[model samples]
Target: MDYLPLAQALADQLHADGIPEHIASLFRRVPRHAFLPDVMWGDGRTRYDRAEDPDGWMRAAYSDQPLTTQVDDGAEGGPGIATSSSSAPSVMARMLTAARIEPGHRVMEIGTGTGYHAALLCELVGDIRVTTIEIDQEVADRAHSALIAEDYAPELVTADAEKLASIGDGRHHRIIATCQVAEIPEAWLVQLHARGRLITPWAPTPGAPAGVLAVLEDCGGDVQGRFEGSLAFMWARGQRRGGHMVPDVDAVPDRITHADGDPRTLLDGETGLLMSLLVPGWAHGMAMEPGASEPHVWAVSTRCGSWARMHPDGRVEQFGPRRLAEEFAGALTWWRGEGRPTVDDFGLTVTADGCRSVWLREPRAELWTLHAADHDDADDVG
Candidate 1:
């Protein structure tokens, strides 16, 4: 009841976050609660029910924070992993702004989620020009019903969006993926118009400080763009991996060596981002064990199960095949050689043959090839 004022307030906050008034106004028109399920999860995975607490639900709906709409991929409660969510209004605005949506533009959204962003796309572009895709059929059906109930009918497709060859090439004027990918899929590049922009959240490895928002433009057949800012989203279904923690390995050390410095420093600032790209397929974490003198820094590779641990006293212990500690140190040396560039200093290029190349400053400055199979399972950090 009377949720318009709350929507307006949320829109105001979006405007304050640099979202254009015209785009933010869409929130005022479309109520966020209309797309949400009756039972939702908020911060700390706490449950919020519309029937039990109507006012709290309404306030949460209009708030700028994200609400989990589906958990455990629609399975009954097991461990409550958020599979899909209504992204924060501010992030939605930022991605929309990055998209540069215009009236009559053919827009394609990769993940429909709760259909809230799809509704916003309909507002920017006409309803007929919006085509939303959701991999989960149940989620897509629910979104379709919500959109229909709101008198907004757009093309809703329930299928995997990893490779959109079936959607045809040179179709969409703008393509946006609500999920994160390890690398840009070549199909997404092919499906865009000559001047189209593809925006998605990308994280090469778990060592990344944060997931980056990549706003790419197709140059002829090749796609390239700079990492604009930080934006963390859920992993795409095809690219999803298992949990990331210090791997369970042999108790006895295979090899030990002296570290150059505190290995934890590798997790600092842009170093982590650089390490993520260079040391692909590896996840890192730091913790002090019970009855331990100092905390240890651990790095484990998801691809090969290689593990490395650096003690607080600069002693590095490594096992398995890859020598992850050496690779990480080499990456750190390279970062220092390049003047310690930040995330903004990096950009990605995906060629016609699907080769991903991450560059520093400019594409020609310094580049590293990222193999398609080198994705990690670590979540993005702020």
Candidate 2:
């Protein structure tokens, strides 16, 4: 079972993805399988065991896809929700490139999921300059063992990433987070060296599995940056969105109205991105019942427990204090009026007071403010 060729093939894929040859070469240097556990979950939650199928596992280890390494936070006989994973090599490469790692720069990784990324950091900046943190004790311990076994030791800490200042003594040249956070912790900004860069996935609300990558650079007193691409990572532990009850359509509706536009289009691409920013603390998705003709689009407001459901015929049913569906429709209208800006045109500015403002095109064109973590309400217009 020669794995070098597979490693080379993965490197080739990374190179094709615009990764520099030197960084792509690191893929060839660091064997991904060395950091993986015996069991891994693939697409559709299909479990693969190295012991049972060595060749298949090897192939999957080199595949350009995320492998779920921890389910339900490593609990037994629980729902198979992916709690952690080895991010696709391409994603790691892109984020590493965004961080722009240098030879002597101190790097801090927020989520050391599989230790593979830590190994790459070690290769770039040496073991002494890298510090990786993971919230789950079990996950951290496993990553630590894997890293040590491979003789690539970095400072591995088992604690919540929210407590960044307490874990390390000094500021770092670069900081990267493996998990998505709704709010960028102020400590991350404060713990950065002058002109330091922090790369992480940022979602509009808690518990979102997918979000745009934030490539922020620290200014003298604030950290500001723009969204680049989308990344799907598990939410930060303390900020994970909890379970919410769905609104019953059978009950007497609080309001019945017609949607401003096609409800399905509200949560797609640029429109979806705008809606997330405009209507914070709301989760939306589309679902189709078995044998149904068309899917139903739904939105639920986490701030007020308001819910809205729209059928295929443009009819909307709302049952709560806030009109989430109406708000989403209004957001879509506003987006169109603004010439439909792409996610790339968006930027974020976090001031010294821990306030986050999402701007359009430029920092001065601030659209709205993202509420602090302690605030129970959703964001409001600036």
Candidate 3:
């Protein structure tokens, strides 16, 4: 396939999306094909036009981009599930931009998915000082092989990234994670030098549209930083332990709410807008599944059960049994009570012992402080 044109097109798209010049140049410089394997390619008969090869899927390995190397590799269903892959180009660009890497900066990366990101780091900073860890042995080996093939190798380790302190001197200037993390892994905080910056996709807050880009500051104790932007990524492997079972909303009868008149109006009108405003971080809207030929209905999972709800307006009654809709609604109510401030109004303070998220109204004024443990399983902001 014609690779250069594909790379140019990808770059153009990134530029159009408001990516900075230097970051876009990095994409232009890295060859994506070097990172992908031949088996990952689609049938040669497929058209290579822009529509088909948008973002250079045909030349995924050659362009300075990320590709999905494996899907559902560890799950019971085999490879049908996208368990892992190289991150997307624009996503990588945004992440790298968030990292704000500088020359001679000591960098540690978690989740060496395809070694694609590692290669980019190697390009930006010499390989000698860059370290990356992957939890999957097979994936790590493949990434190592790819890096060796490209003759640009960095320190690749096949171990749990949660134990980051074992490598190096435990003093990295920058720490980045491509995978989604439920909590700020303690090892990262231990490894980062004072004033070091750590960037990662934090676990999604219930009813939020996307994960927050956690920018951590290593203070020689705990790490602290405010959210930079919205990011979504696959949860870290170890973090995905439990099966997503629906919650029993019926247990809390008092939380349920009902309205009169057109059901769709309640589901789609002010309630919807208010819900979005309240749970700005949630990925989907509240859905009411009317029972077949019956007034009884259930509120199903929205955005893949990222949020749940129970609303009934005569014609339809919906409730979530396995979801956190009630909790989401409560959070929304809390936000409303606080005047519905934008996300910018929120601030975070993390120490080695624990972390606290606060909503700030003005300089030196206290609003609310939510405590988040370093290893809490709850998907709230931490």
Which candidate gets the maximum TM-score versus the true structure?
2
Best by lDDT: 2
Instruction: For candidate 3, write residues 10-42 as lDDT tens digits.
Output: 877787888887777766666666666544523
What are the clash counts of all predictions, listed in order? 0, 0, 29
Query: Global lDDT of each model?
Result: 0.81, 0.82, 0.61
Give stretches of model 2 more than 4 Å off.
207-209, 243-245, 259-262, 285-295, 378-382
Pairs clashing in candidate 1?
Answer: none
Model 3: weakest 10-residue lDDT segment is 373-382
Q: Which portions of model 3 show Cα errors greater than 4 Å?
A: 39-67, 204-209, 241-245, 248-255, 259-308, 311-340, 356-382
In model 1, the runs with Cα more than 4 Å from the true position are 168-170, 206-209, 243-246, 257-262, 268-271, 285-297, 302-305, 311-315, 320-322, 371-382
Q: Which candidate do you rate higher for lDDT, 1 or 3?
A: 1
The sequence of per-residue lDDT tens digits that candidate 1 reaches over residues 139-180 is: 999999999999899899898887667574447989999999
Candidate 1 residue 177 C-alpha distance from true site, Å: 0.2
Query: Per-residue lDDT of 191-283 in model 2, one digit per residue for the tens?
Result: 788999999988877633248989998889689998886766888887776665555545456888876566666776756666786666777
| Global local distance difference test of model 1 | 0.81
